[model samples]
Target: MGLLEYFRLAVRALKSNKMRTVLTMLGISIGVAVTILVVAIGEGATKSVADQVNGLGTNLLTVHQGPRQMKLTAATRNAPTQTQSTLTLDDAQMAATMFPDTIAAVAPQVRGNIQVRLNASNAQSTVLGTTPQYMIVNNVTMRSGRFFTMLEAQGNLKVCVIGNTTAGNLTGNPNADLTGQTISVNRDDYLIIGMLTPKGTGTGGPDPDDMVMMPVTTAMQRVLGAKYISDFSISCISPTMMVMAQQQVTALLRQRHHLMPPFPQNDDFVVNNQTDLLARSQNVTKTMTMLLTAVAVISLVVGGIGIMNVMLMSVKERTREIGIRKAIGARSRDILMQFLIEASIISVLGGIEGVILGVVSAVLLASFGGWNTIINPMALVLAVAASASVGIFFGIHPAQKAAAMNPIEALRYE
Candidate 1:
């Protein structure tokens, strides 16, 4: 018989057991849907991180006082603490001045938490001490007013820039013109010179829009009362110069810190480039996605088993029909093809339904759950192909068993 005849026969055979066919199809569909959903969510999360990092400029490199380490113990309760950072504002200045050709800008930063009060209202927020170069190196833009001038930074003026979230809390309106208004921090009132444009949360970090910014000199002398800097951000002259900039900064800091040959596993300071960090983060996400996808694919295996069980039962129930067809000169290959075709039809149909369900689920998650989800076309194609393959692989044994049965024995079966 022709291929179309085989499909027609397969459909008729499946129609005879409507409920079982539906259940089998449902199983395959769920597997495909889950696999697609997991992969899409994973891809979305990676993309979100990449975008956040890129927003800070791909040519950026961050130099921290030291490599941060997580300490876990019965006493510390798994809290992470940093080793005393030897990096200071002087180190920041030296790096900028020493690598003028490779580095475009350097913004040293110190951070502290403080309670800010504006008249009767009060809010707790992070205060960052940074140079005017911070706005340029970190790609920060002011929504209103202007960034603190270098002269103001040098003079240690009592001035600050409020982020969007802090502005709303202190002034009761995010869009309020707080420029030139005063907010009390550490019992010292600071004039709000500018407001920063809203920047969303960082990758696995605090919201960037929920802090206050001030000149490094003012924050050290007037607010935080500290001498050491937490970190510094450096912008390279170009993307191609990021590696050279990183090398220069590392060598400069290592020599300045007086580290001898054979640098210890834990360096006094570290320099991180944005592109390398992005790649490392993406690799982690990709591994997680693969593991989750493997779990989802197990469901497909289960669905395939269901198809096999049903097909075996089908062969027994249709023994008399099979015997009559064999009696009429039907060949073993013909019977095998018919059964295989039936299984493929079921799985392929289920796969189509699954693709639709997965897309809708991804959209719903992004819209309502506030999650990032990106549906890849390759994922859809792979899911469908996997479903079809599962059907064929599991259906082969049952099809072969039926085809190998003796015609005389099958004909006489009840």
Candidate 2:
């Protein structure tokens, strides 16, 4: 018989057991849908990491305190609490002064979480105390008013700038001009000098727009009560100067800290350029994506097994029909083709439905769930193709079993 004739017979057989056909297709449908959604979520997370890193600028470098044990250990069981930082505000100033040609700007910061209040409104938020150059180094922009003067930072004045989200939380309007007003940070009133433009949510850290910025002197001495600053935000004169700037700053920090050379392994500080940060962040996301994709593949395998089980049962139930067909003019190849076509139809239909479900789910997640989801057209095509391939691969054994039946025995058995 022709291929179309075979397809018609296959459809007729499947239609005769509509409930079984749908139940069999359910595994493949769920598998394909989950595969597509997982991939989209993974892709979205990777992209989010890239955007956050790139937004910080390629010429930027961050200096952080090296790994410190947070948990009690044999080595640290009797040691004094190592809350002190090796980095100091003077170190940041020296890096810029000593390397005028390579280093353009330096912004030293003292950071912590604190309670903020504006009259009756109160919320917990991040507070960053830094120099006036923070705006230049971090590409900060003000929507209203102006950044505090260098004099204010040096004098440790109680003046601050608020981000869009912070303003909204305290004042009930994100776009409200809080400049020239006073807000209480840790119950100390500080004059608001400026309101920053919206920066949106951050990845793997606190929301940038949900924090407040002040002079580093005020933060260390007053707000955070921190004796040492947290980190430095340094900007090179240009992208080309990033490498030289990193080296010069590193040498300066090592000399000033009086660090002995077992080289970098014994060092108490780490300097990371934007490239290094980007690569590290993307690597984490990539690893997570790979793991999730493996789960998706396993689901597809499970679905394929389901198809095999159903096909096997269908072959048993239609034994007499197969026998009668073979007793007439039907060939073994025709019987094989008919069973394969039925399995293919079930998988193909399920795949199409899965694609629809996945796309809609991705969109809903992006909208209501506030997640980033990118549905690549290629992913859809591959998912459908994979389901079809699974159906055929699992259908092969059952098809062969049906084709190999002895007509006389099959007819006489029942």
Candidate 3:
């Protein structure tokens, strides 16, 4: 007659079929757990990307050779690889001098892979040819000694800076002071001027602190033996100036490369600011999260179907009881409510169990798999809400069937 009485009846019914109830609840629990885990992993990945970008500072922008490729086509893929870079060291110098107010610093780099040997220890490592401005533009910090001087970079001195991994391999110690030590890179001996502070892998990229850095001039002339610059790192005066700086640099490069309007698509350079990278990363992660969540929700739907099936069977078995209640003063709504409550109770309980399981799974993944996982409180709420909704949506048909049963027919049934 009352809500509490209906709930009691519902509980009694579920308790009567203990094994069935448990199995149905287990289904819901598994579904909810999977949804939570997938969402948390996606959120963690997105956050990791943001943090990595922030670590490089907000004002940073990178200029690379060639236009930004929006898509890969057969023609583009089959095109010959240009041995010459459209971006040159002079371009970096011009950018710095042209935007003295907007640009704070510019660091041109020449990149190559080489074998580095220090006495009996030898290891293959990436070699970066950069300028003194690299330390400022890229926010590089030294653990020991200091960054190479402007004079050293301009004079093409054979001084180098070692990353944490390089230091460890060369000296067998990560924290060892290797300043003033000699390490041969590609058969060319270079004096270690500084040891960089450790910077872990960021945003799925290689570890910053695992390379050997020297002057761009020295790398081009004596190391990589190339003339064209690889890329340039530009730091704006402030975060607000990043957009202006990017536009200025783009326009400048276009003019320098003779890329006029109607032929702008043929530009031979691309300028990417930090915000652009962050937006792209977020979009990718969002799509991935939605796809995974959809797959996980399918299991919840299956669990809901299981609840519906069990409820239908229960109604058939309790036909005599339903007929007797209808023979008395019981109303159709009361019967419907009773069965609906039973389904809700099962789903809610399963949802609670699912939350616990999901949290544990996320923690285990983060600990053992070395993954980043962050379980948002909203995810818990969403899982529980989804489970409850599933139960109601699926249970309605069975509840309506029980309420619509003919009393006379149900009463005479075996």
Candidate 4:
């Protein structure tokens, strides 16, 4: 039979059961839409994580004082939760000095949310207290100025570098350039010698842009007094020294923290390389995305089952029509093609509509819900393949049942 003829017959078959077709299509459509949205969102989040990790060079390691809380763990007899205390400036400097090929710079950080002001302009932001080595550790570049010298840190100068967000809020205009300006942070005068390049925020902390950076000694002595260090950033002397550097830092911190010989988990501090951290985060997201996609696939499969059952009922209901067509010149293959095409048509249409719905949904969520949602081409391909697979798998039994009917007996069927 001609392609048009097969399509015409398929349309008639579907039209005869309008309500059923519509309901089944709706079920399939929703499944496709959800699959597309979930995978796209997953891929987008992965991309963001990769970018942030790459921003921190491969030789970088982050030092956190607290026990990891985000990942699931096996229940222990008595797992001690960590309170931030393991990191200190002494430890940071020691780490930098211990390994020859592994340690170029280390920057200890202490943070607090405080109000910053410039004359009459004011905004609240997280204030970071770190050394001149912070620039080397973070590998961040100034937009149009310079960082403070080591001498300034030793003397505890009241100089600070500000991110774009902090500057905009303090100046009351984003475009107003801030350099060599005196800003009052917590009622103390601070010279803003540098403005940092815009580094967007991520899940790791509040937006990097919405922060104020200051010398570690000055912030500890003058701004936020009386504090143990919370964390530190370690820049390996080079890529080759990363593992040895991590080991040396870990061993020293444990000894200082008084962790006994047999209990490594009792060590409160964690030394993480940038790529390792990114992989951990991506693994979690990957599992969640797969689970969501699995649920959608199950729904799609269920919808296919509905289509198969309906088509089987259709064959039984139109036994006389099948017989008439077969007796007149239609072959078994023609009947099979008609039914197969109908099933495929349902999936093809549902898949197309689902792609539109999925992309629209992702864009809407990204804009309104403030999520890092994105659509990916690979996600589209996956949706199409899944939908088609469902159609082909479920349509077979019904098509076979229809093709097997005998013309003489079907003609006699009421």
Candidate 5:
């Protein structure tokens, strides 16, 4: 018989047991749907990290305080003491001015969470106090008004810049023209001098567009009462000078802090090239995605096994029908093809249903759950192909068993 005839026979047989056929397809359907969802979430997270990294630029370097390990010796161990921040504003300025060839700009920062109020609206937000060069080093731009100037930073002005999310939290609009308005931070009203361009929620760290920016001097003296800056960002003159810049800055910081190294372990400050850090982060994300993909594959395998079990049961239950077909001059290959086609139809239909369900779920997650999901067309094609392959692979044993049955014995059996 032709392939279409075989399919028609398979469909009629499956229709005779509609409930069982539907149940048999359930495993494959769930498997494909889960695989699609996992891949969508994984890809979204990786893409988010990549975008954040690219936005930060390749030439940027970040310096932050590292853990201070007390020296231990064979004779005696040093007593544990409170670890203080090893970096200061002076270190940042020296790194920028002393190495003009390597370092282009420096943004020393001190950050803290503070309560902010605008009329009746109240919210808690991160406040970043940094030099005006934060714009250059971080590639930040103003949507309206302007960043604080060097004169304002030096004079410790009570002016601030707000990100879109921060503005929305207080003003009920993300794109509100909050520039020139005053918002109270810790009961101290600071004039909003600028509004930053919106940066959507990031996967890597704190939300970039959910914070306030002010002059470092003002943050240290008036807002946070911080003596030492938290961290600093430096932009190298060129990507080629990253290593040289890192070395020079490390040496400068070590010297300034009077840190006698048993090499890097004795150092209380950590300097990282942003690109390298980002690459490491991307690697981590890729690893997680790979792990999740493996789990999805395992689910597919389980579904395939379910298909095999159902096909086997169908072959046993239809033994008398198989005998009658063979007795009526049907070939063994015809019997095998009939069973195989049934299996294929079940899996193919299940896969299609799964794809629809997964795509809908991904859309819902992206829209209402605020999740990032990208439906890869290639993934859809591959998932269906994989399901079909699984059906054929699992169906083979049952089809062969049905084909090999002796017609006389099958007919005699109850």
Candidate 6:
């Protein structure tokens, strides 16, 4: 039979058993839909994480005091933490002014407990003390006003920059219009020089925008009441310089801290290159996405099995029909084509329904979970192709069984 005739015959055969065809298609649809949604969600998660890491500027290395614990081998990888609080603000300043090859700029961070208040609104968030260069090092930009000045940082002026969340809460969620307003930190009013452009969620507990920024000297002396730094960042010049910068920063910090050679025992500092850290994060996300996709594939496999069962039963019930076709001048190839076309039609139809369901599911997930789920056109096309492949794989044995039917015995069946 020609292609047109085979399609017509397949359509008729499926239409006659509409309920069974619909049930089998439903199974395939559900499977495909689940797979598409899972993959889309995983993609969104990966994108969110990538964007968050990118917000930290590219090719950065940091040196800080290590965790005061022995459980983590990571703790020992950098210079060990000093139980005596050995990192001083002066050490960070020296490194900032001296290290210029691989390190572009450095900023020492000091933190202080402060109550941030604007008008009647109040929320307590840690205030950060760092230099004006911190804005560029951190890839930070102001949503309204600009970051603090170098002079301001050097003079230990009382100006502050804050994130969106902190601004909102202090403004009572009416308007985070804090650019010109003074935010009282530690019962001391500081001019809000600039409000940072909103940087969204992070694993660092809250968005960076939520915190307040002030001169490092002011935070250390006035707020923390100590002349020490909590941590520091060495923004590398390029991705290529990341490793060199890491090594250079390690040596520099060690030298500044007056640590002897091979000082593995409780040395006073830590150095981190964010390139390797970001790569590990990407790998983890990729692995999770693949794992979710693999789980979803099991459903597709089960749907294919369902298609096989349906087709096998179809061949058994239509034994006389197959025999009649064979007895006439119809070739086994024709019989095979008829069954194959029917199975493919079932799968393709299911695929269309699956695409609709998947998109809807992704939309709902994005809405409720604040995830950026996007099932791209390519993914939808691939799902349709996968469904068709599933049909062919499952329909093979049944099509063969029908094609091999014995005409004489089939005609004598009651």
Winning candidate number (lDDT): 5
The TM-scores, one per candidate, come to 0.92, 0.92, 0.92, 0.87, 0.91, 0.87
Could you tell me the lDDT of residue 31 within candidate 2? 86
When 1 and 4 are scored with TM-score, the better candidate is 1
lDDT of 1 by residue, 1-414 (tens): 999999999999899889999998988899899989998999999999789878986479998766434333476556565666778899999989988889999999999999999999999999999998998898889999999999998899999999988988887887787888999998898999888998876545787888889999989888888878889999989998988988888888878876655553446788889987889989988999989888889988988898898889888888988888898999999999989898888888888888888899999999998889999999999999999998898889888988988999999999
Clashing pairs in 1: none
lDDT of 6 by residue, 34-132 (tens): 888988987887777777777777776777686343333565556444354557777776766666776688877887667887777789877899997
TM-score of 5: 0.91
Clash number by candidate, in order: 0, 1, 0, 1, 0, 2
Instruction: By lDDT, rank the candidates, best first.
Output: 5, 3, 2, 1, 4, 6
Would you list the clashing residue pairs of candidate 3?
none
> Higher-lDDT candidate among 5 and 6?
5
- The clash number for model 4 is 1
Over 4 Å off in model 4, which ranges?
1-4, 15-22, 67-84, 257-259, 363-378, 406-409, 412-414
Off by over 4 Å in 2: 68-81, 115-123, 184-189
Q: Give a tens-digit lDDT track for model 4, residues 221-339.
A: 78888367768998887787888888888888888766665545566777889878889989988998889889888878887887788778878898899889889988999888888
lDDT of each: 0.87, 0.88, 0.89, 0.81, 0.89, 0.80
lDDT of 3: 0.89
Q: Write the per-residue lDDT of candidate 2 for residues 306-400, one digit (tens) a residue.
A: 99999999999889989999999789999999999998998888888888888999999999988899998999999999999999999999999
lDDT of 2 at 32: 90
lDDT of 1 at 18: 92
TM-score of 1: 0.92
Candidate 5: global Cα-lDDT?
0.89
Q: Global CA lDDT of candidate 6, please?
A: 0.80
When 1 and 5 are scored with lDDT, the better candidate is 5
Clashes of 6: 2
